[model samples]
Target: MRPHTLALLLLLLATPAATRLASAACAGEKFPAGRAYAACEDLPKLGASLHWTYDAAKSSLSVAFVAAPAAAGGWVAWGLNPTGEGMAGAQALVALAGSGSGSAAPTVRTYNITGYVPLGNVSTPLDFPATDLAADAAAGGRIRVYGTLQLREGMRAVNQVWQVGASSTAGAPDKHAFQPDNLGAKSKLVLAGKSPAAASPSPAPAPHASGGGAASSKSPNAAAAAAGVAAPVALVLALVGFLATV
Candidate 1:
């Protein structure tokens, strides 16, 4: 390859690595802009963690729960109780292990937790966009389950709980695994960002006529912005690398 061509190829190769580094840094901390959670709390007892982002502007709530790996393939369930205490009368999202060919994506079911015994029956799924759910292998022969829930509601908070099982027939017996037990500490849905009503309108700044040019690149905020701009390019390079390896 020509010297300049080789240099260009090397630059291209570095692009993906740079992008991955940036993404990894943001991993659990960031979600899709409007979809990201303001907090991620660990459920140590259940070997799981929860992340949530609330958009007060749109009255939307995005939730993601990751459970510890279950080698035999199991299930993870998250419940939201509008009334408070235990799992009774809570809306639940249960993710079960995929079967056979379609196993890459775990099947998700919505339920209404009724009765003191926590008998959850199939209920209406949320009207919001369908969530992305999957199970993947983790270190030490464990399987990790990841899922997201998007909800549109007026409530500011709700009591939450999570459960996991050793088999796919977990949660309700009609579903899979055995009965799922609560995993971690007390959980709830709390809004993070500013509410629409709390935000005050600010007048737009007048444009400067003098050609002072753009702000200094060395400025801390400017550097951060530049890094954000480069993120997309890095992601593209990472994709190219994966395709090349394939």
Candidate 2:
């Protein structure tokens, strides 16, 4: 193949990887309905997945949880640790199958945690199922629950946990199925929109004499540096292509 053609082919082959890296770094990340955030899915022994996004301007935090439906019909609970610790002092949202006219829809209740007990009736009608959860129920299955909550001052960071339980009937006694039970293992909820630190300008390198001998072409450092430079160039090219398509 002609040298120019070979170079063009190599550039084209690098474009996809570059585009993915660029998107991951700078594009707005979205949490898909009914799925765990990719960053939290790998937590050890995690049975349920939670995803959250915070809108600082609106002072709101939207959270979603996804877990397999209990075979015998039960409840799924997500809790927040105001102190960033254990189940104690946690605020939980519990979703259970409803009864009577709203039986088809799941009902959500809020509780303030103390030890193993859920105290107080903080349950409000604000919590509801996501569209995917509704669709799943319509198709004879249930898998997801989502809702938005007002973020109080200094609530930007907190510990979070999930639990699943078996309940014979709606509002019946619940049998715990899964709970992390360890504050150390609980996941964290971090709000978005924090400003990143500005980078200090790097000093320009001293210029070498033009008549000096060229550096060794086979040097490992030289090759590595060249590879690093090429990667960003490829990313820029891929980003340009993506913007053009948009």
Model 2 segments beyond 4 Å from truth? 1-44, 98-103, 118-142, 168-170, 178-185, 193-246
lDDT of each: 0.48, 0.47
Supply candidate 1's per-residue lDDT for 101: 63
**Candidates in order: C-alpha RMSD to true structure:** 14.6, 17.0
Candidate 1 versus the native: TM-score?
A: 0.50
Candidate 1: how large is its RMSD? 14.6
Candidate 1 — what's its lDDT?
Answer: 0.48
> Tens digit of lDDT per residue, candidate 2, span 110-207?
66666776333345332221222221132234445655566565555667766665563436436564443422336666553221121111111121
Question: Count of backbone clashes for each model?
Answer: 11, 0
